[model samples]
Target chain A: MKRSSISSFSNPAVIAELAAHLHRNNVASIHIEAADGELKLVAPVGASLQTTHRATPVLISASQPGSLLAKAPTAGIFAAAHPLRPEREISTGSAVAKGDIVAFVKVGPVLVPVIAEKAGKVVSVTSETGTLVGYGTSLFTAKT
Target chain B: MIHVLGCGPLNTIQDLGRAGYRNIGVTATGAMDPIALKVGNLLVGNDEDAAGIEIQTFPFRIEFEQAQVFALTGADCAARLDGQDLPPWWCIRAEPGQVLELSTPMKSARAYLCLQGGIDVPLVMGSRSTSLRGSFGGHEGRPLAVGDILPVMAGTTISPPVNGFGIVPPAQAMPNLFPVSDTGDLILRAIPAGEHDLFGDDSERFWSQTWKITSQSDRTGYRLSGAPLQLSAPVELRSYGIIPGIVQVPPGGEPIIQMSDANTAGGYPKMAGVIDGDLWRLGQARIGSKISFRQSSLTEALAVERAIDAYIDDIRRTLPLVANALVAMTKR
Candidate 1:
């Protein structure tokens, strides 16, 4: 099977596969952007497809008022917790302080922490564990 | 510099090890878990062969005399920096006067602490590793003690994230490569040695039965207890060169796997030699743990080595990128 990239989202087959993966993994949403365009897919609770749109790429999005996102600093795999640690660093409704590591982006053998820019309560963890994430991909949505 | 506040005997400084002098009867004494030491060194931007502290006995406590960047790898010792819990396989900067404590690990054996500049122990026989038997290398050629002050080599300073970062431990990252028995015994891959066929049926038994690591085990070798392995016929043999991981069965019919501090030569009947790539896992195996052997080929052994090399290469290539990205992000 061919690997999917941001550019491949224009293909219907790739989009369908990605949506199926999102539903299978129970992911809340995925927002991807490249120089050419952007693709946003939101799978609501128990729903396969709630919203799918193509819009101007916004590097950082404040989906909810006063809610900040912890974005991926580089492109890599998303890990909710350090692979060696049994406990997740942050989850929905968890309180986090500024500079707290809410998640990690694993670029091959290296693990880069996704730090919370501001102290807030995590409203949602947008990225699925073990999924590929791009630079500026929202990992956690937190409200001050 | 760092001051050893509390420590147990046998914790010493080690690099990759002193090589080539084994023929002259000098044992190659190095960190039991060499992979951990290498990874720890790399994490702190040191050469892979840079010297570091190998802590097997704990609780080890030290006070950093100056602000230093360090990395801790290997066994999850539940380390704490000034009362803050640090993750295993992690690297961070320790402020001057900050205390770092490491408790006994719940699982696995040995933990490594590598500083940005590496340990400044005088190299004897071309390595910083302590030759406990020879008593000439490392921090005065003996294990560290309380009040011992060790110097650090000067190196270029590189900033890590405030809280530091960690890599996925090799055991967790490459679980499928090494096999574990159904009963939770470690399965080590080995190649048949010079006298393997001499044991006849016992050689097969050696591969089949699970052996328990006896308490007599040390850095020199592991004395395994299992069903006594006997040879088809008794034969006299001349002493021959030996290396780490050589499984030899003495007249007592028990197997002893030579380790990092292995003797230069031995006269015992050889059964098999564990692959070098899996020696790190054996190094981490605790006394009383069970282990089994799986016959492997040279091809398979090289494959395992390549896999390990790939892991290290990945870390070397990505660490700087991640660090640079984090620095850029924080500056924004």
Candidate 2:
């Protein structure tokens, strides 16, 4: 098939020069393969704006269809460990059983333990330590 | 009963001063800071006027002869129970063998350790307070010494083990309670006494200048260093009854404020009287520290007294709730 859009740039020298310019600008892919083909270019999003879509859900794991997301049980300051034992932190891949204190939330001077709901390996810690978190905010992702 | 392992030279057992006895000749030798004694008593669930140990020296050591619930108030003495640090103004349970060591206070001049009940010394003249001059009451009318074992009152109720709370001293809880000087001098509120006019210009100077607390001050009286206050003339005055807080300017240029152990009567020209509410600040005043006078009224003094009462009432009301809450939390 032939078209005027691609035909206008039919010269091999002009086409090569256009491709070189696009490549220098870090464009990922370009298509002008056919005489009638519309020119198209794609570039990876900048690192600062890597994830621009809000509706894209994060998958905890590919192998597990129902990977567990550990959420805050109550609204308070999310602490990775007890306030008294601040040096201790919940490590990723650490095994936790049901009712085990995987993390804590500090309410004033009192520490409230966040118990695990199911036996699992911590896939990732989602909440930053000492940050105020609301109820149901993701604290960790675990694979049971 | 508790055994004194070590104590400062001035440590003694005290309660609220002996009431209705100044008519005789007995000085009401009691805790310099009566509010501290009262608060410590309340923390441990005792009568506000319960006799307790008043520690003025550093490294005061005591061993519990029996399991008891006790509270420490007043100064932050850096207390340690068997090497573990104890919070000031806190109530804690002590096992029979636990030794509590109270070092010199970091910010105050005295500390009060009160047991669950009042001290069990024989009440003389209807009070358990020590009469240092009469040598009649409170652990044989002498300061507590090593090897001196004080028996706590029998059947004194032991508070719950979970009871743990502290109170900020009234003077510290509100900055406005006792006005502090810019130079850090403790400015005590005083009411001009009967002889205040006798000093004339010196009276004005007394209210304006900062007076240094001299080393000669003791429980009986605080000798102050300032301009020599002179009477309008050398007048012979009859010996009259005096109470704590009376500022007596004696021979020479210094002023003297009577304390908990002061003589019941005096003949010195009294320029002012430190109000009952602010005497505790003078109690905590260390030697070499400076003090200023703030002229106050009786109505204002009564208000400060009410404020202190309200503070104690708050602690009394909130402590049980806190204890119950702590117990519930621990069980979960």
Candidate 3:
């Protein structure tokens, strides 16, 4: 995970190669030093002509809202209504009181009902039935 | 020592990678899945990135020519050793006559097999890596086929110590995992490069809307197609050097992800590049998978770089020093 640095070079060939990677990754500043004092090949910002510039950054921002969902903290299959009966409205964001049956999921073979946390508008649903969803997949979201 | 079964297409010997040879157009061709290699190596007390077998899409079955400790990583292949199931990411000292079989993987696309001493192949151009494009390094620049028996270098100071089996720790020491698959949203953060301003705003926005990886994906590059971006005018640029993350957009307006073994120079217009740490995840992507792009600031990208460095430091701290010291000596 070290900041992999490429040896600085003034050769047009080497400069172009390094630039393309740095530019695509958006590496704004490139450190350049040469023993011969014969350094060149510098380009203006947004110089889209050279292969030497590439952007390389990833920024995580709070602007983009991410939802955290609660699950059984275990395993089970999912259902909208009670087992051995007809299914009903299971749309995400459906309102339900505390302790109301929100969905049922089967772990291995046994079916278990998942209770609602607090009353809220559903934001997003995570999985489909028997989809082999992992421990992290977001199940139907409830927006408070 | 062992008898290689099938080296799979494009399979060959590899080490940590070939480095410091960009002056001569030589690439640091190493394992596509470094996390797996690190784990397998750790299981057997071998230094990370030691030479091993890289099986892309496997049913790899190797007959043990000698008793040795071995481990598997990368893909969730149904590893059956002598007709018995074997646990993944754990080291096992096998009997001399044991034959290990790994069925085609179900979870991942590539599989890495790390042995106590590692697969010994001749070092060429300062590495044991195979660069087929140059047709030189590694087992004659080819995959080991049936009846190909690689003789392990005699008198290696074995690390896992013959009976060194114990509770293997987690493959990575930290939780900064480079995700293998994009959960339905195959998006990558990139900065505009050589051709950032060529396309009109509408066309550029359309690119992020719907683009799919064409079936023509390969080790050399990944071609994506959907709609063409309108350019201000057709400008011709001279050929220039290239890198793995470079994205080249042709006159037809198709974008391609240049990968390892990519040409050192190219003529087409370059677009954007996948982040370095994220590029490794590309190794596990299935063909025809959807890929999306997001623009990020250079400042943010550099921050991502720092976090990665910190994560690596955590893993390196727990590494057994025996192999690292020995490997360092040979590298010097």
Q: If the candidates were sorted by their lDDT against the true structure, best first, what order would they fall in?
A: 1, 2, 3
Put down candidate 2 lDDT per residue, B1-332, tens digits, no spaces.
89999877978889997888888888878899888898888777787898998888888999999888888988888788887656567677888999999988757788999998778999898898888788878999898999999998753443443324455567645568878888777889999998889887888998998899999988998999977888877767899999999998888858999999998898988899999989988898898899999999999999998987787777666455434433322332
Q: What is the DockQ of each candidate?
A: 0.25, 0.01, 0.01
lDDT of prediction 2: 0.73
Compared with the real two-chain complex, what DockQ does model 2 have? Answer: 0.01
Can you tell me the DockQ of model 3? 0.01
lDDT value, residue B114 of candidate 1: 96
User: Which of candidates 2 and 3 is the stronger one according to TM-score?
Assistant: 2
Query: How much of the true A–B contact set does each candidate keep?
Result: 0.51, 0.00, 0.00
Q: Which ten residues in a row have the lowest lDDT in candidate 3 chain B?
A: B162-171
lDDT of 3 at B122: 81
Off by over 4 Å in 3: A1-144, B154-183, B319-332
Local distance difference test, per candidate?
A: 0.83, 0.73, 0.58
Sum up the clashes in candidate 2. Answer: 2
> DockQ winner among the candidates?
1
Decide which is better by lDDT, 1 or 3: 1
Question: Best candidate, TM-score-wise?
Answer: 1
lDDT of 3 by residue, B157-219 (tens): 344322222212222222233322245645566777877787658347634565677878766
- Of the candidates numbered 1 and 2, which has the greater TM-score value? 1
